[model samples]
Target: MRKIIAQLFISLDGVVEAPDQWHFPYFNDEMGVAVDSVLGRADTLILGRRTYDSFAGAWPEREAAGGEDAPFAKILGDARKIVVSRQQLEFTWRNSELIKGDLVEAVTALKKEPGDSAIAMSGSVSVVRQLLAAGLLDQLQLLVHPIAVRKGMRLFDEGDAPIPLKLLSSETFETGVLHLFYAPAEQAGEGTYEDAKAHLPQDER
Candidate 1:
């Protein structure tokens, strides 16, 4: 199964929306580099309806507007994306599909499908929450911004169990952001994962 990895940008106070600004100037060199790095790590894309709508209006025309090199625009133009939407709609971006189904089931099927690259979640808080709650996420990459918003949507919603994470790596950017990589902690004295799997029931592991 392809691991579903979530790469998110968040503020110190847990705001996922508009870390650059609430209204405009959404791109920055720091954000661009971060996204480009993550894109190199995955192939499949999944997004919620709101994020899809927002992206559809922006990326296709971005090249003509001299923004094709933008991290999202470049990837959206090429990567295979499953846009989770109930309403049927034609996609403006190339290599995109509109998936209208239960988010968890649909994502689960996608992960099960044979693929070389890992799946990734971007810009969609609702979809990210669903993946995290379902225990579908294999790794988390967070670029933590220093700003604190009074109120806004966040990356992780309620009902998230305290699944322990082992810190894999951490680095700071010139913008004062911290890039943290985390994966589920390996149990102490645990043998190879295959050996561990044989001992624990599939569901428990």
Candidate 2:
């Protein structure tokens, strides 16, 4: 089975929205390599409607321009793109498909289909949260920047419940961004995940 990995660029305060406003300064060679690695891992792309729209609007043009970014643009343009939406969409980008059904079931089936691991990118918080809640997300790669956005859509916001994550690895870039890789922690003793929270650090608790 292919792993469903949700890769997010978030600020110190957990804000994941509009990285365009605060993320450019930190982009460096290391970050480029990290992004390339993520793209290399997936032959399929799972995107929420907003993210899909944002990507479809730009990547195609970049792919045509042929520059340092052309490789990523090609991946975005050529990968099997699945946009999760309830309404019909006229896909302008190549190799794009619309998924309009029970999100959980549909995603679950997609993950089980034979293919390389899939990666989900920005502006897909709601969909990512659903995958996390349903235990469908196999991994989460968070590129955490040092600066805080102060006020924006955060990855973990109000009303969000704690999710257990076991750290798999981490790397620190010279630009002050941290690449944190994690997998879901196995359930402890059959109780709810909240029950396992007792073992977490006081600051986290």
Q: Model 2 — which ten-residue stretch has the worst lDDT?
A: 115-124
TM-score of each: 0.76, 0.87
lDDT (Cα, 0-100) at 22 in candidate 1: 48
**1-205, model 1: which lDDT tens digit per residue?**
8887778878788888855374223346766777776664566788777777777777777845765456556666678878877788787777789875787888788889998887877778877766766778788888787777768887666663555678999978776778898876644553597776787656754
Task: Give the alpha carbon lDDT tens digit for every residue of 1-205 in model 2.
Answer: 7788888999999999999999999999998888877765578888999989999888899989998889879877878888988889999899999985898888888877886566555558888888888899998999999998899888975555668889999999999899999989865445776888888788744
**lDDT (CA) for every model shown?**
0.74, 0.85
What lDDT is obtained when candidate 1 is compared to the true structure? 0.74
Look at candidate 2 and give me any clashing residue pairs: none
Which is the leading candidate under lDDT?
Answer: 2
Give the distance in Å from residue 149's predicted Cα in candidate 1 to where it truly belongs: 1.4
Tell how far residue 62 is off in model 2, in angstroms: 0.7
